[model samples]
Target chain A: MPELKTKLKEYRAIFDMKQGELAELVGVRRETIIRLEKGQYVPSLKLAMDIAAVFGTTVEELFSFE
Target chain B: MKKKNNYRNFHIITIIVVTVVMLLYFIGNIFPDNKWLTPVIIFVYLSSTTKLIGPYEKKDELTKINLGRANGITLITVIAALFVISLIGSNSDNKDIFASEVYIFTALAAILMRSLLFIVFDRTPESLGGDE
Candidate 1:
């Protein structure tokens, strides 16, 4: 299976954001943010876009398949 | 997150309560009458289905995915168990294995499996990867 590597944690850190805050902004559960950061989950396009938008980045820049 | 946790807790509590009630009924110590067994069994089945199919707008995509996976696994497990029980009933002289009590037991087991599996899926990581 393709692994979905993410820079979600780094982005959150840079933004000084909490997982719960990011989740709220993206309209998801905090656990979902944790999973994405751990690369344990692959977000949908809409979620990816939302998260990227929150961090002022593009989805391609936030996530990559390995 | 709090809302999701509450929803999860509600499901776990409901399943546990129903399972305990069904077990007590099966033991025949608390309730000697079988009049309420059918209604209780039906309630369990309906509640389980509702939990699986009800509105999940409060849940995220990952949670929704996990829920689907859990329900799928529970359905297969229950079907396999019933098949085995039916086989046993057909080949053995003890046809009482196909009794209403057994159905109730199966329903309880299915819901319990679904709830546990959902928790497991929700907590476990999905695949091998790391934050970059």
Candidate 2:
């Protein structure tokens, strides 16, 4: 099975953003952001788009299936 | 965040209230005569109190998904438990546990299980043990 890998933590670091701040920006719980960073949760298209937008990147840039 | 806190607090309060009421009923301190009345009162109280909490709490996508998962698991577990309890009750000559009590216990257990599972899912990161 292909796993969803994310560059969420790297992107957050580049933006100097905390998990809570990113979650607030993307309208999700901090835990959701944490899970995304760890590749434990597969986000919906809208949430993926929202997070990617927050980092000023495309979803394909932030997330990949491996 | 305030809305989220309120939603969580509301569920915690409901669990505590139900547990106490059920305990009192089981101990023969309240509703000793009318067994069905206890569940009816609990159901009415829960429904009425839910309206008081308002419907304004907007859950995020992850929270909503976790809740759905938790509810599904809780339902399955409760049904399985009830089946096992009935099977044992039918096999044994012990008549200590009444059907109404079993129903009340099952409802309480289901509520507790769903709430606890939601809390766990909401708070715990799934990859906590993984290499960071």
In model 2, what is the error at residue B58, expressed in angstroms?
Answer: 2.5
Instruction: State residue B94's C-alpha deviation in candidate 1, in Å.
Output: 2.5
Q: Residue B103 error for model 1, in Å?
A: 1.2
DockQ of each: 0.36, 0.39
Residue runs of model 1 more than 4 Å from their true location after superposition: B1-5, B33-57, B124-132
Best by DockQ: 2
Docking class of 1: acceptable
**Chain A accuracy as TM-score for every candidate:** 0.96, 0.97
- Per-residue C-alpha lDDT of model 1 across residues A1-66, encoded as one tens digit per residue: 889999887888899888878888999877788788888788999999999999999999999999
Which residue pairs come into collision in candidate 2?
none
DockQ of 2: 0.39
Q: Ten residues in a row with the worst lDDT in model 1 chain B?
A: B123-132
